[model samples]
Target: MDYLMCHIEKEFFGTTFEGIPIYQYTLVNKNGAMVKIITYGAIVRELWVPGRSGTLFDVVLGFDSLQEYEEKNASYFFGAIVGRYANRIAGGSFKIDGVTYQLALNDGDRPNALHGGVKGFYTRVFKAIPMKTPKGPSLVLKYLSHDGEEGYPGNLDVTVIYTLTNENELKIEYRATTDKPTVVNLTHHSYFNLSGDGTILDHEIMINADHYTPVDENLIPTGEISSVEGTPYDLRSFKRLEDAIEPLKDTPTRGFDINYVLNGKDGELKLAAVLKSKKTSVRMEVYTTEPGLQFYTGNFLDVKGKGGKYYSPYSGLCLEAQHFPDSPNHSNFPSTILRPGEEYRQITVYKFSMEG
Candidate 1:
């Protein structure tokens, strides 16, 4: 496959505690799909794709300035890597191999630990190596996690490759190895708004999931593998996000923020979910080799982002593929433990297409 690379001068919130320069790089594909990524947490600054009318728009919600990201305390993550453990860990604690571990709590008012605590991967600067691969120009990010950092055992070396394939697929390949047993679950947290503006409530979404894990008021799973047969959680078929979100306005978070068990026999690469914006005619199909997919509707984005834009609730949505939340605490959930000599690998593809 043929590819081209370019860099655009852009400043973002500095990565240092004292505030420094934040540089970003923009990579564009032959089809004109562009992805702007920064070294800070390897966050994706912008993702521009062709619309139905041959125009381009930044479909992903992000800040245009670093100060906005720092001031608003944005929870969008905005194309950042979430790790050590993704999603919520109930009670901010879990047990593995008869050993209990306590994690740092950072879920606002909730007691559970979320997205790897206050200073997760999203706040760190990763070492980026731009490579010219046979497939295309890719950016490989490497980060080392010390033992007991964020209360996770074992020293882990993680490598995440972000590749823009010629087929219009933004492929994320995650690989990690640990010297000791550790709970590892990682996924990209990008709030996608294919229409580029307005709320994503009208976006249509479909997940190839027959069962979903029910959650309590705190947003932690109830450990029950309930079928999406008759509830509003049902998305086994195509449905508008607004259709399901409007009725769920009373729930905590007031929008879709639940994890669905991707239905397809064991955990394999299957169609996880498909989202389409009728306004832009841009559609995204997600495929992943993970056990579950967390569909978050950007419910907590009530702060100002880049360019002084205040992102309201449901401004964007995310479909994160990973192990179930609190899997380390629930014995019935799929295993998230990575032992020595075992390779932890996960592949997620976001294929983009448009209709006239």
Candidate 2:
């Protein structure tokens, strides 16, 4: 694990749907923490960090090859950047500036548009720039979405930077601007299993949220911000996911896939969540500037990932920091609108460590 250079390397990942070339960028920090990101969809294919025993393990679940990522239909998002709008949009329609826009109904039988109507940022190739930052290695990804590309208004220009600092922090900074009013809720979809090969059910979870947005059967927010007082959604203190989710295992929701309203100022980066694997003692602290965090246990993960690994339900978990789900349709929730002349910026940092 010698990282004297802390170099940023690149290699060919795969081609796009249109047969365009795509590249993978590898960033290694001074402490030997490594991360691999592909230009196609700006996907984070692998992230390796040291465990308590000084063993490096890939914490994020992803396909071994880009071909698998391209051919798979049920992505579960894996380790990609999902955007335009992250969660479900009710009825696949929303009103902006007194005009109603209809999107493609991609979520079957749900009457909603899931993850930006099928062709979201997670499926598109992006322009990447590798760089050497003052603290460590970094890469910047840029993409532009034309007006009405996915039945959404505005020509949006977006830039996201992934920086690996010497202190073992994977910092993600997102900035965007639009020409017309549109809904924008960008979030990273990374299924994390800190123990590398085991289920995340034994992982301890802690969320800094006093309330959460309840959802319907279709997973759309009901526009009510209810307190997490006595419900199973309470993760204010550290609790094993297995114990926290056992009560809801028989319900319609099945498991944890709800959005918790972060307790803090919306625009300031604050501690949102903390996840630790009891087996490996690998800890990840999530800090974000967003208003909410979507905590999803990989309840539907049935894909085969890297090294011929078959991922089962609850194999991994996701802590997606973003705005509330269906924020555009719910006027009571925090707004996800990006108006003309206004800039959209959010920062989320995943700092990793080992518990002694």
Query: Judged by TM-score, which candidate is best?
Result: 2
TM-score to true structure, per model: 0.94, 0.97
Residue-level lDDT of model 1, residues 230-309, one tens digit each, is 89889877898888888788877788889999977455678899999999999899999998999998877776665667
Q: Candidate 2 clashing pairs?
A: none
Q: Model 2 lDDT vs. the true structure?
A: 0.90
Superposed model 2: Cα runs more than 4 Å off: 1-4
Candidate 1's error at 210, in angstroms?
Answer: 0.3
- Model 2 lDDT per residue over 207-310, tens place: 99999999888989888999999999999999999999899889866689899999999999999999998788899999999999999998777878889899
Model 1 regions lying over 4 Å from their true place: 4-15, 18-22, 71-74, 265-267
Query: Candidate 1: how many backbone clashes?
Result: 3
Error of 2 at 60 (Å): 0.3
RMSD, each candidate, Å?
A: 2.1, 1.8
